[model samples]
Target: MKTARAAWRRLEPVHGMIYFVPEARRRYADLGLRGRAGYFASRSAAFGRASAELVISTFYNFNPDFVRQAVDGAWDAASPHQVLDARYAAVGEALRRAGIHELPNLNEVLALTRRAAEAACEHPQGRPLFAAHAALPWPDDPVLQLWHAQTLLREFRGDGHVACLLSEGVGGLEALVLHAATGEVPVGLLKSSRAWPEEEWADTEERLRERGLLDGDSLSSDGVLLRQHIEDRTDLLTLPAYGVLGDADCERLAELASPFGRAVVEAGLLKLG
Candidate 1:
């Protein structure tokens, strides 16, 4: 239902900003990370002691070679768990330093978010990818539970999006290209972050142009439709989790969460972009 999508839109700004917040990234660097490369390498490594390729291919949905290149020597510098711990600690520190108060009714938000997220595990049909994380014991701390719930919902939607993208023949840079076309992500940052060769990036753009999904520097009408289709499907896939609360509750959750997210944004700790 539209309410599910509406609720997700409201919650997204809060749960998703951690990845883009400058302070969080700075925290990783402070912990001895080597820049953007080390940040991705370490953060994505949180799932466990896995190869960079596997993490990229699974969690990041990026080219394995690119991730491998970025993580070439990161692990030797710091273990995965150490990096993961630092990332979490940094987020908390960043929030504190920003003076961004916790969400009002923190306990209520935590209870609601956790319950809805955990419900997804009960009937994870078509969402088997969430099984590992879903099975993890819930944290006792309300803030930690909130974080865990956010992570689970994110992965649940992400894995489904990846499956849909693959079916549409969009992988790695191509998927990034389409995402940039949507006007949400800046092309330059995506290009640099994915570590794609200039020529390869240009070639992909040309290919997309030929497919009528792109114009000189923007998505064509068809491109917009294609992107919308992908997004609509992604939203639909997330219904299994959001549905646990029903439409009214979903809106209530979103309403309760928006202020907390706004506080972080207002504090300049997180950027909507």
Candidate 2:
């Protein structure tokens, strides 16, 4: 299970970096998408004319009105096919800019990652985002293919995560509050990015406190337990995808993927702070 998490973490930047990469936004802008609309459009375009309501559900944690503003008529700017094209083009440009293509073991890493990613596509029962993406034709370029694989795996895990959170009674806002409390990401960044109002954020915190899941700005003991349980269940759900690769191969994948992931971060393509 730890191998599953570690492997995914090592490969995450390959896909995630594209969001912050300038090339991606530039292509989106070419298609008339501006501001956060590019983000909402580029990510959800895989859903072919997806309604804002659908994005609100799948994107979970973002303010619904904010989502509506971002995704409303997004397809009018560019068809889903065009949006997906621009997305992969960004992956290529950004990775090339980062000199990721120069790595000695790029092919080896992508091959292993793709195997697990394809295996994940086998069970898309409740993973809507993953299912939508898995249906797309595979990119001929190995670089784009690698990025596509990580995208599928992450979304697969994400869909399962939403299920776990809902089962644990953590609504999107509540989940964001708890995540903020963990100190992994600043509350200001989350609140600003998600467009959650200060009043709502505070109210969510207060409600969490009332439920004994929060103490001040952090998680209470019960909250800690619940968070752990959610993550554990999420890991368990994502495990079967990696299971096809077995523990040893997954470890090798992590080892091979780690340097590239770190290289992406070091290249300043993905500024987390």
Candidate 3:
């Protein structure tokens, strides 16, 4: 489990930088996907004309109305195949700019991450988003392939995370409120980014209070314990994919990928939500 987490913690930036970069927005706009529409569209492109409800279910933490608005007419504006092409192009541009191609052990990191990603493909029973992505043909370029690999790992962990959240009876907004209590992200950012209205956000918090998961703005002792359990379970769930790497290779994956992740951050490619 530690290995699973360490591997994800390092590779996440490699996959996550797509959301914050200007390149994504510009490319999505070129495809007529405006605002957050690009995010929902490009990420869910593998679904090929996925409905908003499907996006909401897979994405999990976002507001249903906001997700609907994003996915509405998205496929009409751009086909899933086109969105898929555009997103790869955008990532390529970003990675080239960030000097990812110039990094040492680039091939080595790619090899490891790809191996882990393939392992994820084996057990897709309830992991919808990951299963959708895992079906896509691999990109030709090694760098793009590396990005795709990390993307798989991220989605694999994410799908498991959503399941864990559901098992804990944590809805999207309630999960966000609990996340805010831990201070991993600011309350304002989490609420606004997910498009939860202030009233709805407060209402969610009030409900958490009633359930004794929250004490005012902070997580109560019980809430903290539950949150820890959720995280532990999420990490454990990822082991089936990462366990194939064994502990040493998992740690090595992190060490080799650290510089690449740092390059993205140093290049200022990453943005806070």
Full-model lDDT for every candidate: 0.70, 0.89, 0.92
Collision pairs in model 1? none
Scanning candidate 2 in windows of ten residues, the lowest lDDT window is: 264-273
Taking the tens digit of each residue's C-alpha lDDT, what string does model 2 give over 46-129? 888889998899989999999999887788888988988898889999888777888878898888888888888889998998
Measured with C-alpha atoms, the lDDT of residue 22 in candidate 2 is: 84
Choose the strongest candidate by lDDT.
3
Q: Give TM-scores for every candidate, taking all chains together and pairing residue i with residue i.
A: 0.86, 0.98, 0.98
lDDT of 3 by residue, 27-80 (tens): 999999999999999999998899999999999989999998888889889999
* Alpha-carbon RMSD to native, per candidate: 2.8, 1.1, 1.1
- Tell how far residue 224 is off in model 2, in angstroms: 1.1
Predicted candidate 1 versus true structure: per-residue lDDT over 1-273, tens digit per residue: 677766666555556666777756676676566666655655465455556766676755455677777677777766767776666666666555544344567677666677778877776565544665676666565655676787777778877888778777777777788778877878887877677788988899899999998987688998888888888898888888888889888878887877666766776765533
| Backbone clashes counted, model 2 | 0
In candidate 3, which residue ranges exceed 4 Å CA deviation?
none
Error of 3 at 62 (Å): 1.2
